[model samples]
Target chain A: MADPDSNDTVISGVAPGISRSAPQSKEEVIVISHLYKSFGSNRVLQDFNLTLYKGQNIVVLGKSGSGKSVLIKCIIGLLRPDAGEIFVFGKNVPELNHFALDELRARIGFLFQSNALYDSMTVRDNLEFPLRRHWIQVTQAQVNDMVMEALEDVGLAHTVDMMPVELSGGMRKRIALARTLILKPDIILYDEPTTGLDPITGKEIIDLIVEIQNKYNTASLIISHDMNCVRLASDLVAVLIEGKCYALDTYDRLKSSTDPNVKPFFEQ
Target chain B: MATDTTLKKFLDETGRIAVFTGRFLNEWFRPRYEISEFFRQCYIIGYKSLPLIGLTGFIIGLVMTMQLRPSMVNYGVESQIPAIVGISIIREIGPIITALIFAGKIGSSIGAELGSMKVTEQIDAMEVSGTNPFKYLVVSRVLATTFMLPVLVLLSDCIALYGSYLGVNIKGITSWSLFWNKVFTNLIYADIFPAFIKTFFFGFIVGIIGCYKGYHSSKGTEGVGRSANSSVVVSSVLIFITDLLVVQVTDLIGYG
Candidate 1:
């Protein structure tokens, strides 16, 4: 069992099975070690290790089907890892009971790949969803205020009553970001945030992500195949290949590195 | 070779049905509620299904009355046409046919919508948000279907009785007052209550199975089609199974 209160500090003491040294300074918020997962015969993740610190934007770069989404899904408990451990906020994810897992989840936000906005809900209703579910004691005025504030944060305040279908792809992404912000989470996970947008809109989304992270001081883990996004959004970059992380470094360092496999991906 | 193929098909169908039922039961009690999503599902699963159910009920009544009239006339029981068709429609035909129609329309929609949501990672978004997607998606749908099916069945029964009257008057002289008098006179509480009661379960099965298929659907467009097809097929089959049990129980309790 892992202590829920000391979730951030526990990751530094645990290594990725073979390494004994800590990956970061004392401010680490997530630590994953020897994590393994499989779906039928497909082994998606194998003995993967990662450590994310507070306010760090860790971009996971991988080709499609390289299990970047699975890694995040495991951390969020949507998909269970076969072996090893995940500690978020110092709580070992697998050991935490359902109640604790839920409590932990409430403090985290996720921006889905497709924006995942409920097609049936208006933008206002979509933003209101998490608030209403978890914060029942909040007054209607407070809910309204918060929803508007979140929408304003994403610059979609005027599209409150519009359904998801009515919005452009970029607007939908912003609306999703607004929905993520409504929870006031300490951490936000983005799955391919700019996969389908025009380059200009994609850049705008990247800037919005940075803005949100800086303003909220929320740690972000972004999974994307978009190299430009990886270059712009990452404080540290991890390239996932062959079920394990090959490199975790700054953009300039990874770009200049002589490692054969890591070099081609960064160069391209 | 033919027997082997048939056996394999039977096993496949059986396995699918079991999995569908099991998943629905499992997801029913799971926590997490998406209220806005649920209401939207209700509108789709319940409200939108009305026109189709209504139309089917009307046709069933008209056809049933027309078919039975000449036979009753041959037996010199022409006066019993409305009474017989009315009892048949209210007691069984109306609820069952409407439910089958409901299963086809609403069940398929719930399946496809949820399937697409699952594929697109929307359900995943809800789960990661600390919201219980199961409670929000599955339970709300089940609740809506449970409540709405009865209303739909009642409306269907009423519309069907009207259609039966129209059929009765097509070839013969019958006043609306006298026609209804004959129909209602034979229909006791026993004939109506059991039939009405069964529809709630019918709705529950349809909603639960449709939602179960959609919510657990695999990734991509292909999964969406599988969900829709399974929802209709499974719900239609369950309606029959449920109708059979309801009939047996009604018989055991001496409803006839």
Candidate 2:
């Protein structure tokens, strides 16, 4: 994203009433510079850099096994990059101690590929896990309200009493998202949010993601290969190729890009 | 080369277990303890294992008495059967058998549960949810097993004694009070205390190894199955080894 001017143009028809933020309000929440990470001889990320601004969704598009998950993991301080700086909220993520990392994690919601809802717990308990674990002080009434509100956000308020196993695939993903929403995170990282769902369910999830983004106005770094998700939810599309952000632009602009590396994503 | 690889893997696993133990020790004493989860684990691990332990104990006691009857009659020492069975059960068989059963059941359960959680990213999700999975899962479970096994053994010993009483009257008449009196007259603290204390070691070995195998499980579904299988095998082996070591120590301490 060398040209700051390119991001000002919004892609329409994907999400209506999305309320995409003004360019002047772009505050950098996550900044990665010259990030390099590798495992054994496999280089997963190399000199990769990205910046996520507040109230914007940046979709990192990549093929499977192309370091998309690794990139998000590094951003969330789950994995330490081999080299370079990851400035998350002005703190070097890799440099922070355990306590600091945990504090940072509190503000970032990560929706895993598998949904990762606690199987042993009812939907209500799963949603309350973050709030209870973080030692958040709120009245029981307030907690109930918060849980209900998060469930309503994903439109699964009735499933709170049911266990995760009883829910369908899309329902479970929605419940997981509700759990993530319980924290009211400043940033949400979606790791292939639409990976396993059917096409219609995937669209609904993408719409819900956009709705959440618009409703909360939180920054999001979505890693996905799903073109619909990239097209609909992304305010800025970061094309990841060979362990780097190969191209960064609006989805429409990236769709029309002539570069061999960036054309396949938009070829549909 | 194969032997070398196997040895290296074993040493690596040993080192990893040591480090995991050290980590457990470090985090267990830290603040923000998971008290509720700990108690929940205690109930599940301790209270839930009662039925199986009791049934097994009863069978073992009945079988011991019946088997000893033949030998006792041949030596013309048939009247001493209760005392002999009581001494042997409390001193050795009771604790070891209960522990082996505990290892088989609890070890595999923990391994499979945690391994599934690991593979499905639930453990990682726990971390991201602002909870230390180690404290919530591993520490709670390990401490549960540590405290639960001894309690189970104590109860099992009692049940086995009752079963022995039933077995005694199967052939000949003996009053309940008389049977108990004869059994207790020969029993001493030396026979009981060492056996009771060794079970804590047995419990700790089963727990730590089970947790270690599950927590570090990889390779997805196959890895989870391997974790469950090996948790049982490793814990059972370690239980015997720990019993041997603890017995040696007890003997040196004049409790033998």
Using all chains and alpha carbons, the TM-scores for the candidates as numbered come to 0.87, 0.95
For residues B1-256, could you state the per-residue lDDT of candidate 1 as single tens digits?
Answer: 9999999997986787578567657866554445665677677766787788888888888899899987899999999998899888888888888888888888988899899999888898777666777777777888788889999999989998898989998999999899989998998999999998999999998887888789778858999999999999988988999999999988998985
Pick the lDDT winner. 2
Off by over 4 Å in 1: A1-25, B1-44, B188-190, B248-256
Candidate 2 Cα outliers beyond 4 Å, as residue runs: A1-24
- Note the residue pairs that clash in candidate 2: none
Kindly provide the TM-score of model 2 when superposed on the true structure, using C-alpha atoms.
0.95
Residue-level lDDT tens digits of model 1 in A1-268: 2232332111123122111121234576889999999999998898889988877788888778989999988888888889999999999898888778888887788888888898878998888888876644788899999999999998989999999999999999999999989989988999999989999999899888877776877888999877878877777778787888767777666677666667777777
Score candidate 1 by DockQ. 0.63
Q: Lowest summed lDDT over 10 consecutive residues: which window, candidate 1 chain B?
A: B28-37
lDDT score at residue B248, model 1, on the 0-100 scale: 94
DockQ of each: 0.63, 0.78
Give the Cα error of residue B47 in candidate 1, in Å. Answer: 4.3
How do the residues A1-268 of candidate 2 rate in per-residue lDDT, one tens digit apiece? 3333443222322222244532314578999999999999999999888888888788888888999999988888778899999998899999998788889998999999999999999999999889988878988899999999999999998998999999999999999999989999999999999999999999999999988887888889998888888888888888787888877777877777666677787887
